[model samples]
Target: MIFVSLYLFMFCKMEENSGHISVADFSKHLFWDVNKSEIDLMRDRHYVVRRVFSCGLMNDWNLICRLYGIQEIGEIAKQIRDLDPKSHAFIALIAKIPEEDFLCYTTKQSTPQHWNF
Candidate 1:
């Protein structure tokens, strides 16, 4: 039990300190349409942040949170127009930011709600 705990601690520290995250670290389907090796985490922060929020699992979320933290992710989320509704709400609540701060939320408001009728 101690060994597993120690290993987990070390793994989390490595992820936190490492500035790079590869596509392969995520689920296979997350980047199916792109060359996994070519995607640079820092250069493609917008893309990675969007896909991770929209389609990534809990592990993926945790990884990004560790790498970028809730504040950075929330800032990235602000510019992502296609972020899912649930994901948007989750981030807003977690980041303690209002829904109006998110581009997705504001854009959504600009359009007529189909569900309203």
Candidate 2:
């Protein structure tokens, strides 16, 4: 029982720190443009979950709630994936960072200005 409790505690701490992990670390692990600042992820797991959800990436509510204290990342991801191409583009525009911003960061462009509106 004690060992089980200890393992659970460690697991929770690991997840907490994982959510606090830097964008660079996450990018290195995933090999994709997260398109958000490091500070954003460090804020809170819920924030990151919401960001991912906004991108239409959350579909499994139970998993999302368990993983990120939210309940929609899996559903959103599925919805985005199911969208028609043009409609997906529109949805992406509504939820994601502007293409220019994502491009600027991906290309390592310095002093890049994000969209004002």
Candidate 3:
């Protein structure tokens, strides 16, 4: 009974983790606004790429690139309208894409410093 239970437990653990990338592996501070475990990579790719590339460190950047590739990441990042200039430039350079090709660059907003409450 003990041997069978142990085997089952290990097998289940392996099955659950096989070829799956969980958000929990990212920097904890990056996901403070949401429940980390509920994030599905395929379904939540836009959110994941936006958060990791915008707010995460180099390691996080490398991880996402390895998992999703530069082409895919650039495609997603280009669509985000509010990405900061620094982050936008970084991705544009690494992805080897012209700045004008990005939607964010083509439709950038003027500085919001003049807005009043």
For every model shown, what is its TM-score relative to the native structure? 0.73, 0.24, 0.73
Provide the overall lDDT of each model, using Cα atoms, as 2-decimal numbers: 0.74, 0.37, 0.71
Instruction: Answer with 2 or 3, whichever has the higher TM-score.
Output: 3
lDDT of 2 by residue, 34-75 (tens): 544544533555444444334433232222333542113222
Q: Is candidate 1 or candidate 3 better by lDDT?
A: 1
Candidate 3, residue 60: Cα displacement in angstroms equals 1.2
Locate the minimum summed-lDDT window of 10 residues in model 3. 8-17
Rate residue 82 of model 2 by lDDT. Answer: 23
Ranking by TM-score: 1, 3, 2
Per-residue lDDT tens digits for candidate 3, residues 46-73, read 9989998668975566557656766788
Q: What residue runs in model 3 are displaced by over 4 Å at the alpha carbon?
A: 1-20, 110-117
Which residue ranges in model 1 land beyond 4 Å of their true spot? 1-15, 18-20, 109-117
Q: Which candidate number has the best lDDT?
A: 1
